[model samples]
Every structure is written in C-alpha cells, then in structure tokens.
Target chain A: MLETVATGHQAKVSAERGAERSLLSQVPLLSELPVQDLTRIEQQCRYRRFTADELIVDRDSPSTDLLFLVRGQVRIVNYSMSGREITYEELTSGAFLGEISAIDGAPRSTGVMAIEDSLVLALPRSVFLDLCTRYPNLALKVMQRLAAMVRAAQDRILDLSTLAAQSRVQAELLRQAQAHRNRPNAAIIEPIPVHSDIASRVSTTRETVARVLNDLARKGILERCKGALVIHDMRRLQSMVSDVRG
Target chain B: MLETVATGHQAKVSAERGAERSLLSQVPLLSELPVQDLTRIEQQCRYRRFTADELIVDRDSPSTDLLFLVRGQVRIVNYSMSGREITYEELTSGAFLGEISAIDGAPRSTGVMAIEDSLVLALPRSVFLDLCTRYPNLALKVMQRLAAMVRAAQDRILDLSTLAAQSRVQAELLRQAQAHRNRPNAAIIEPIPVHSDIASRVSTTRETVARVLNDLARKGILERCKGALVIHDMRRLQSMVSDVRG
Candidate 1:
C-alpha cells in the first residue's frame, strides 16, 4: 500500500527521528552519509507498515520507490506459472529493496512479502537518485552493492550449471555452515535452518532434503535435531560438497 | 596487459578521437554525456587489442577497468573444476564489461575471452565514478544497465528452479527464435546458430542438444537445414516451452 500513516505527535516525531537516524546509520548504503544529510533524508522519507504475510510489492508492478526495511523481515519471491513459489532471498531490518526499479523506472522483477510486521521508509526515486549524484561516495557504494549482487547471481548460476540437485544441497549446507561460522559464538546454536527453506534454496523438493538428511544420519554424519539438521562431521560434509561442487 | 601503446601519429590521434566521440555517443551509459564531456572521456580512455582465443579478463583478477568493446566479439565464461567450460554471455560491438569490479573494488566474477581479434577502450574506475557523480543521468544509466543484468540473472535463476534440462533447452531455442524475429529480415538466415553454442548456452551436454534436435526433426517440428536447425513449428515450439517454463 502506498498510503502513508500520519505522524503521531511532534514530541514522538522528534524521538522517532532520533531512532531512525540511528537505524539509517546502520544501513550500508546510507551509513556513509553525514548525520545532517541523514537527517535531511529522514525528513523526506515516508513511512508505512505491513502485516505478516502481506504482499508488499507484486512482480511487474509499476511501483518504483525504494523501500528501506526499518523493522521485521521480508522475502523476495516470484511464482512460476505452475504456482511454484521460488524464494530468491530474504532481507531483514537495515536491508533495502526496489532500488533496481526505482533507478531504472522499470516494473518490479520479483514480488516482496512481509515475513512479519514490517516497517519501511519509502524514499522517492527522484530523491534517491539526486542523493546518489550529489555524493560520489554514495554512488560508489551503490555500485559496490550492485556488484556484490552480480557476484552472488554468478555464484548461483555456477552452482546450477556445475552441480546436481544433491550436490547443490550439500553446497547450500556448506554456505549456511560458513555463515554460521562467521557469526560469533554460533557453534552451540543447534537445530538451525529449516529443511524446507534449504529445499527452496537448493531448488529441490523437501523430500530430497529429508532423504539426504536421513542418509547422512544413517552414516553417523549428521542428524536431525527437533526442527533442524545438525552437522557432526563438518570436514567430511565440506569435502563431500567440494568434491562434487568443484 | 595494463601497459598502454604510445600514440603513433598526431593526425591519427585527432582522427581516431572524432570516431571515438561518435562511438562513445552510442554507448548507453555514456551516451547522455555532452559532446565535450565525451571528448574529455575519450582523451582519458586507453585502447587495447586482443587476438582470437586470448584471455582478456580472468575470473577473480584484481584488475578493475571498464572495457568498452570497440570492435569484434568476446564471451564471458567460467570453468568447472573438471575443466568443463560454461559460456555465460557473448557481446559484440558497442557493449562494455568489467563495470562490476570497477565500481565495487571486487575481483572479477567471470573471465572474458576474445572470440575474435577485438579492440577495447579501457576507462579507469575513478574517472568513470567521477563522471557518474558529475552527471546523474550517466549514473542513472549505469544503474539501469546493472538492473538489466540483475533481471537477466533472475530470469535464469527462475528457469533453473522451475525447469528441467529438456525444458531449459527448449526455452533457450525459444529465446533464440525471438531474438531472430526481433532482427530485421532474419528469416532468410538459414544455416545459422552453431549447435555447440546452443549446448553451452543451456548448460547441457552437446549430446543432449543433438538428441533434442533429432527428436524435433523426427516429429517434423524443426529440421536441420545444413548447419542450423530451421524451426518449422514456431507456435508449437513456443507453447511447448511455455507449458514447461511456466
């Protein structure tokens, strides 16, 4: 919905602006901007809220404003004609969406749905483009972000081209394992990553994931703990993935 | 090679700059720049030439200069650990590459090889970023170009997720046929499109492509007219692709 909710009170507006200023500071794209510039941007930003599972943006829609995730989570997804939902990526608080269409004046390529109650700040396309031009550093940052995105897509393409469905699942596990490693003190965090989510990520059916996990469990490699799979032989799992992935 | 070749004759430089001005005008990212600005950019641009089968850019290379294809053809490719080459995309004249790293300061995601004897104009990242900041339209164009890349990747991802090998091959054919239709009077262009190229594009084995083509010919859907397959059943072919691709 494009409709904006009016600000509550002047005092509350002041408090929210302060909180927003801090939140905007954490956003990779806007973090480089000065506090004054951030405040300026905050003033022009329009706010909206979406409920859980609400469709925020539809694929091929004409909406072009960049949505900054102020709170909650959203998933970028597109459904095939057969009604198969392909989840592309998920963004939590601080990540932004719709910049592609916002800059290019094109329709949205993928739809976005709020995973939970999400609050977003909609910055007009003109204002964002103006800010990018006004700051070369910001423009460079934007380019870097886009570059990262291209690399990610290239990685996915490589996986699809080089590996089969089973190898892809292992590679997906390795990727999550690496992400887990990167997080400080995440080692004891058991039962992580939903199997269905893993299936979607590897572009395979949940049945395949269940079979893989069960096979691994029989071999004393990994086991399912409650809602998630736990990797026991991490090195063996890595080798199994790299052996086929390579 | 980062080394620049010394200019031969003053008259030659003067003549080439004029041609370069017009050529720069055709580049979508730089087209919006004024004649004078294009000239200025042309002055800073360095020229390089590569022989057929020469590696122009290597995957994960630290070099980061945007290369504008002035003449001939090039292909972006990456190899699996087993040494199987997967061709990503091919570009001819008036196209460019290396912008992802040039903007982001990241390593190249894929390697570029010269398909034939080709010439390129290399623009330094700093100068390109400066021009982008100076001209919002140029930056907007840059974003649009990047957006186009993202959309292309997303489309590929969708195909990978929803379609199997056979469907992908058919989809690729449909894509090529559409591209053929878009070209003015390309109907008489029989014996076009090498089969090996088709295999590379769909990320499948050449044997699979051969089998699919043979099946289509047996069914009188498409026939191999010497070097290329002439698609006789266009509507049926499209419908077959959509039925699966959807």
Candidate 2:
C-alpha cells in the first residue's frame, strides 16, 4: 500500500490503496468519512512537490484545488499594491488550504509559498465538492474548521487593536512557542523565521521586534540558540502579555 | 397557510404554515431548499420579539438556536475581561446568527443585542442540523457565509495592522458609506452610532474620531445632520482610503 515510486534526495512516496486510507484517516475532516467515500477521495488526490521558496499558488489566481500538506511548511501571504508583503499565517504539515476559495469559487485571496521543501496532495474542486455533498459529516467538519478560523482571526484583531508593539511581538512569540512546544514547562522553537517575517506577522518593524526580543533575552526570559529560540520562563512571558492586555 | 397570532406593540407574529414557508423562502440559505424541506424548517421555528437595546443572547451563554432576523437590526459585540467593549459586526434583516456556535457546539462567542425592536425566528439546533444533513445545498450555503465572514475578518485585521488611526477611521467610514449608500455618488448614513461606538470599532479614542470627523466636515467632504451624516463627496472620501492603503 505504501509504494516508493522514486527514492532519492527528493523522493516521491506514492500512496497505494491502504496507505491512502491510512493517510485520509489521519486528516480530521476526511477521517470521519466512510471507507468507500475515503477511497473515492484518495483516488482523486494527486501528489505534488515544491522546493523551498517555490510559489505554489499566486495571489488572485484561479487555482481552486484543495491542498493538503503532506510534509514541510507553507506560508499564506498577500502583497500590497506598493509591493509590501504581509504574511497571514504559516501552516505546517497536515494542514489544508484553499477551502475558502474553493467553497465560494472566488479568485485566490492570498498567494501560498513553500517555506520549506514540501509534499502536498491536491484534490480537484469537483471531487471535494462531491465529497461534501455526499458526506454530511464532512460538511459539518468543514463548517467547524471555518468557525474556528473566524474565532482565531477575531482574536488576532483584538490583539492588534489593544496590545502595544512590544506586547504584540511577545504575544506572537508565546503563541509560536505554545504551538511548537515539545516539553513540559519549557519550549524550544526550531527553525524560527527571520525578524522580518515575525514583524510582518505581528505588524511591527524588524527593528522593533529585534529590540523587544533582545530586551526579553536580557531579562532571562528567552534565549536564541543556533536556529531556534528557547523560552526558559514561560510564566514571566505570559505575565508580560497579561500586563499589557490588562 | 398564513395566520395572525397577535397584534400589539411587542407581539409575536406567529406565522401560519404557508406564511412560514414564504418567509423561509426569503432567507438565502433556505430559499434554494425544496418546498417540503422548507416546510419542515418553518414548522420548527419559534417567533420571538425583542425591544430596542434588548440583550438577545449573553456572551458564553449555551444558546444554540439559529436566529434569522426577519425585521430590524442587531449588533454582535464582545466585552473583554477588562470590561472593554468591542463591536464585532452589525446584522440587518435576512441575516442569520448562532450558526458558528451551533456548528461547533461551543459557547456563544459574542453577545447579540437588538439594536432596534426586532423580530427573529429561532430554529432549534437539532432541526438546523437535520436540515443540513438532508440538504447539501443548505450546508454549502452555510459554508459560503462562513467563508465570507472569515474574509471580512481578515480584511479588518489588515486594516488594523497597516493603517494609521486617521486612515483606519476613514476606511471604516468609507466601508459604512458603501454599505448604506442609497444614491449614486453620495451616501446618507442614518442613525449613526455614537462617536464612542465608532472609536470602539476602529480601535481608536473617541476624541480622535471627533477630531477626524470635524476635519472632514471642515473640508466639506461630509456634513453632520440631525441624526445622520451626509457624505457629499464619496469619491474624495474613497480617495483618502486609497491614499492611506496604497
């Protein structure tokens, strides 16, 4: 079921019937689908690969394929008319994209780029819509995902409205730490993006982010390692956020 | 199938069977549904009335009923832990609420208050879900609405992040003008919310909003009438937003 069609530095691990079922089972949305429906979905998936910094989908493009990240990371971004880039979100493995455009049949709102060499499974819009129509639970799951997305956006708006620059940077750091935390009472975020990327996410300048981060490091709250950040005192960092929000 | 149940200042307009179907037919989600399915949905709706400024649903309340605004307006707002009020959105007739929480089975994310004496038809969660399961088109319609909501929230975040205080206020006014514009090349926004409310929506102080409005009035871009703001130069106001955004 797991067939290695090509094995090299950049390999293509083709999924057969059983492997496809297992992969679909791991996805929250497709997992609830019945075995037959899952099989149908798997049959429609086409595996694709992109190297780091590759443009997967251009902004305003008419691409409506649903993409599921099989490996690595992708960033959704928008470019202003003046050529300023705003990063909306960074999604890692197992996350999906293009649901909004696919559902509404509108042009893509943001461009998606591969931040790291990535493997993705693309499902055509027709197949995705058919599945949603045939499977009620799948439709419900999609709605739930959309609802959660709306809530997260609202939270971000609240932070941007109320928090100061330093607090916003700190809050974004804490958020990333929580997302990538692997140990208890501490978090080590590896492969951290550059200060400019962080600035774009938090809507601040790179200099501001650097200043706040350096200040935090001086306070013994976090340390910058080779390619990651190690948060030593999460409680202190959390209190900092509360102080600003309060 | 139409029947008049009551007639008073605050009376429940209990809809008869045919009248209920006709009313449901007006809702975007239910309009496309088959007549029989629409009848089923109408059978489950309970007519409700609220006076102006009535608290229809409290934040975090376990109210899962789907509210369809039949007449009048409502505001969705959130109060922060520190008692800061944020107005999320305003809904008018034919719009639906509570779909997000009902889909996710989470507590109400925001409080819904009637901005005017409003008439709403509340559909129980079970009936809503049943209708969704049986009618895929209805589910698709719900997904599209959620998608639109997500996009709007994202737009708001962008405005908050990139625009300055004065520009943010101008952008919000332009948005309102577009929404309530009745005449070509001009707009009349009636019963405008207080300056404090506008400040809350745009994430600025009331004094700043007043200053901006006074400046605009002096420039002859807008005029403050008894209970409405008349925009004499919609193009000029719009160009202000483009200048800031660009």
What TM-score would each prediction reach against the true structure?
A: 0.87, 0.84
lDDT tens per residue, model 2, A157-192:
777877788889999888888887776657998886
Fnat of candidate 2:
0.64
Interface RMSD of each: 1.7, 2.0
TM-score of predicted chain A against the true chain A, for each candidate: 0.88, 0.83
The two-chain DockQ for each candidate, comma-separated, is: 0.57, 0.53
Q: Write the per-residue lDDT of candidate 1 for residues B22-128, one digit (tens) a residue.
A: 55665767766788887788667877778888888988899788888878799988888887777878999888898898888778889999999887788898887
For model 2 the interface RMSD, in Å, equals 2.0
Per-candidate Cα lDDT values, in order, are 0.77, 0.80
For candidate 1, report its TM-score: 0.87
- lDDT value for candidate 2? 0.80
